[model samples]
Target: MKINPAHLGFDIDGVVADTGGAFIRIACEEYGISSLTLEDITSFDVVDCLDMDQGIIEAIFGRLLDDPLDAGLQPMQDAVSVLHSLAAKAPLTFVTARPHEEPIARWLEHFLQPDTFKSIRLIAMGVHDRKTSYIKNLGLKYFVDDRLQTCRKLAEAGITPLVYNQPWNKNGHDLPTVNNWQDIQALCAE
Candidate 1:
């Protein structure tokens, strides 16, 4: 696909990879805290809801971010196929809040099929409002993300933010939300 960066944008984490699942896996397998449910992760700061110590949170994130193991992060069930289609038709850009570069790019590469989305862009803007800033600066007409806060920011800035449904940030927002990649494909095409 001859991708362009002017129109559509995406956020990684919950939207693309099941990072939340990976986090829960760590909390259960490594951190010795099992029995956590998706419903319990009421906030983006899921560790806070887990009643975990700061050190444990840091360790979990540290492993996930800086020194993640070889365990492959699972892509959204429909993500690979949907993204291939979208990237072929519309300009697709990925802007994530992850601070590092290699891990995320590598993760993306893992699922990127051969001869697809040659011009696809993966941009990292780290923390805070950087995601919003990047989206605005790029003048993206549409964006998909799981963070309601980020989606609200994009909506306020006159960008269409398509909320990808997750356990956290699923309620209290009347914004356009999609349940799966098929919905994302439909929404973006709309």
Candidate 2:
């Protein structure tokens, strides 16, 4: 399909970087809970998976303010290659549910070099509800995300959402799906 870069939107957590593992580990340590496997945490809401109230989750995240750069997060397979290719041809924006920018920026800086990070137009952060609206307002023609509910809502809102495959969202029966960045690149190229 040869989508123009201006039309694409990307989710950060599962799409660009693998934040799940770190998030789960931090959740466990901060909340004094046992480590959760992907299977155990997938069905639960983001906050519930951490076994903490929203307030505590926010506080734990805040503590990370000092040193948010967790070298533990690795880019999903083929993510950098695909992003590089796409960015070379078009604008790519990273839309995330992360509320803060500094930590996100620090994390990205640690993982992705300056040239790659600069290719991104903006890293939208904050609550999930606002993300859909942000994509709409920006006139994004397509979006890639790992959350089933988010993908469903994006599709319902009239945007083409390529649901990035995740074990947590595996039971879904909606939206177009991609297993990794390689698949996503092919989908966008089509």
Candidate 3:
């Protein structure tokens, strides 16, 4: 099969939505972590800074997955707009480590135009490194994600990885990183 060179991919949580702030808010309001902030989430794992129990974090993650498109989790408006524009020209796919597709599909549907995407791809990857295989199989020409590890893997596999800037991935500026959807729009326009 021939891969569509125009096919673009995105990551949920950080890149497409403000998962960091939403996560910290959930942790504080629901899990009783009163003093958490975005700065605390300097790493991919919240437990590293919040010092919260793994189970609690897991429960929160489950909640995020439970109603993945919860309105409280603010969608990145610029990204969605850019997505629609790109979708007008070519297919756009959202590839995520989220275990289920329905919630995200529903969530994305709420924000995007009718034809804004070709698919919402989900992977049962409990780790970042596992996404490389899915990207390869999908034959995505370009992939955007906030995790540096995933970006590295995509680059190693010869797929152009656009590193979405986030607090956790700020240090890895060496990667082909983008500051916002505007940067993505620019890249896709090229």
Each prediction's TM-score against the native? 0.88, 0.78, 0.85
List candidate 1 segments past 4 Å from native. Answer: 1-6, 67-69
The local distance difference test score of model 1 is 0.77
Error of 2 at 164 (Å): 1.3
Pairs in steric clash, model 1 = none
Backbone collision count in every prediction? 0, 1, 0
Q: lDDT values of the candidates?
A: 0.77, 0.73, 0.75
Considering only N, C-alpha and C atoms within 3 Å, which residue pairs clash in candidate 3?
none
Q: Where does candidate 2 stray beyond 4 Å?
A: 24-35, 44-68
* Of candidates 3 and 2, the better by TM-score: 3
Mind sharing the TM-score for model 3? 0.85
lDDT tens readout by residue for model 1, 23-87: 77888888777977667778887655667787987777777776443544677888998888877
Least lDDT summed over 10 consecutive residues: which range in candidate 3? 117-126
Among these predictions, the greatest TM-score belongs to: 1
Report per-prediction Cα RMSD to one decimal: 3.3, 3.2, 3.5
C-alpha lDDT of residue 17 in model 1: 81
Overlapping backbone residue pairs in candidate 2 total 1
